[model samples]
Target: GHEHSLTGHKQRGTVLLRKMEISVAEADKRTGKNTVNMQETYTVYLIETRPAESVPEGGTPAAPDTLWRRYSEFELLRTYLLVTYPYIIIPPLPEKRAEFVWHKLSADNLDPDFVERRRVGLENFLLRVASHPVLSNDKIVFLFLTEVMNNLEYFIFFPETQIIALKIQTRFISAVFSRRFMGLKHYSDELNTIILQLLRVRARVADRVYGVYKVHGNYGRVFSEWSAIEKEMGDGLQSAGHHMDTYAAAIDDILEEEEHYADQLKEYLFYTDSVRSVCRKHELIQYELEMAAQDLTYKKQQKEELATGAVRIFSLKGMTSKLFGQESQEQREGRIAALEQSIQEGEEAIKEKDAECQEFVQKAWTDIERFKEQKDKDLREALISYAIMQISMCKKGIQVWSNAKECFNKM
Candidate 1:
């Protein structure tokens, strides 16, 4: 049990050193290099401030008869230093009461370098506060003074100062104010102020330490709340980074799809242009076919008119020959021979025109039929190509949609 108690005390001492606002070298110097073994001999130098009030058997508060007196400034300062100073320092000064007066003097407009001077002066002061043997030990007053000093420490950079002011404020508030909701009739406003001020000081101190270390390249510990805040900011940034990545991918996909669509559109335009050119040529062919048909009909009409004129001339020739009355056999034979030759030549002329007209009609119809067949074939091919293009476009659209859905799910 003694060994365990010694181990616990060593652990506490180590922890206290670790918590100080000092360098490792400074902590080592303050605590010394002595090994904290269970069997080690150590001397305790504490000066008891006061005796604790005796409580009843049931742990009840003492009656009004057990009166407790208040403390004087010198005695209070001495007691307060022993208690509150440890909260700030590592392996705190054994007798720090004399240092409190120096801190108070420094706060009252002493030289800026007084803090260094006080550090030196304290070496002698601790011995005096410790060796003094006439001081009363009032534990209650000391405990109250410790709390008062801690509260005052927010506004005053000192080991201990006018801590009684804070206690007076607390007493004043408690005496006049009562909170029914909290069931707190004696709660101190001065204590609340200390808590609020401490929180504010913690934040300010953290910022100062961080700023100084960053600028001068020095040392300090991180505030407890800083890690939590930094973690939250990191999470937010990671989330934003993911969103940006998804957006970039979507943009890339859209650009690729647009390029593909542009390619398909270019192909479709080429095919449409080709079909339009073919259709233009087919239209020209149809026009030529109509003109050929008109030319053939005109030629047929001219042939009919020529055949009618030949028949009229033949009739006139026969009438004239009859009216003239040929008496000699030689003259009549020559006239008959000439008339037969003219009639043969007229029939040959008619046959030749009819053949030529038939040829024109056949050629015109053949050309028109060939043009119509070629045009129909071209139109069928164009329709088939257009249908195929539409099917391909639909399939591409479906593929793009599926790809987009997949990308979205991955996101």
Candidate 2:
């Protein structure tokens, strides 16, 4: 489909963020199909915008882009962005709207008002994603905003390619034959190298996650030991006829710092596990790639052998078999198309994995910054305050002892 405009403006500069609406009611067969399939209806988000930077003065204002995305799709897009841009904090999705009484799994989720609530949530979600420093520049946000088409049909048929293809493969075929036609080994090698690097980084990321958890654990121990010491000091100060609680106020700051650290540690741990899952997913994809390359190579070799007349022929029956056994152009194209689709899918999968990695690493970096801020700076200041309090308390104790000694001498 061509993006033809009546006003003849094909490409606009930057589409400014203006308004977004969630379209609950629409008269389209696709939306109808969606409603029927899910037994519940979903809404579309209409992103209205005027290209401020791109449009010329007095030029015709183009129509707003119509975008329809399901809640799951919105979730997927958010996850994709999170994976792609690690540092940016993705905006949260709208709460699941219920049309009726609150329940875990209610059909009310599909109600018009409920859907509207969700639409607003999703709109907010997109705006946040677009306004962010790093995420705004990403093409994915643009694609999500501009593309209205649903790929439900594509996903349904895509997995079947593997099943249809597995029948074409029986056992391990020689890389030699396939290499003569299409370069499977090269692609495989390149992928292997890239995946290996990713795997190594993944392992390091896992280690970092574990390391942060250990730091949090060690801090817990520090708090325990500090509490015990504080209690002992409290008893001593009380016995010395001083108010220990006044000096103990400094411990509250320390306690708050520990809480902050604990929260940060939990966030890091979650991302760590998330990145590990992504790595496992990619590892599985790598195996699939190897097997897929084998399948593509098989089709390629048969096509090449038939074209060159390299397939052996001993008798008239054998000749007939050889001629008939030659792969047809259509089948060749299908295999080639399959390989391309597989590659495209792999690339998309990688984009997700890369984003997860960014999320993992960015959290770690941000944690480091927080550590410096909270533990290094704030904690140090708190400790100094505590020390000053201890010094002042000791001075008070010294004065009391001196006065008591003076009284005893007078007695």
Strongest candidate by TM-score: 2
Give lDDT tens digits, candidate 1, residues 1-411: 000012222232332222211110101001223335435322211121222334447886433222121112333444354333211111112122222221112332123233223222222122222222211133332233233332322433333333443333233221211122122111223323443454344335434533432432211112222323565454433333343334334432332222222222222222232232222222333334444555555455444434343323345545664588533667546655665565556556555655654454454335334333433453344445445644664565466445545534543
Model 1: residues with Cα > 4 Å off, grouped in runs: 1-231, 310-411
Per-candidate TM vs. native? 0.21, 0.31
Q: Please, what are the lDDT tens digits per residue for candidate 2 over residues 1-411?
A: 011011111121123242332122331213455444665344555555434454458986565446555667776776565444333334456555432221222346555534544554455456545544455666666666666556533322324544443333333443223221133234334434553454345335434533543453454454445445564443333333222222233333333232222222222223333333323333333445465556556555554554555654355744765678756777657756775676566566656655654454455345334322322342244335545644664575466556434533443
Locate the minimum summed-lDDT window of 10 residues in model 1.
20-29
lDDT, candidate 1, residue 295?
A: 57
Superposed Cα deviation of residue 60, candidate 1 (Å): 99
lDDT of 2 at 278: 29
lDDT per model vs. reference: 0.33, 0.44
Clashes, model 2: 3
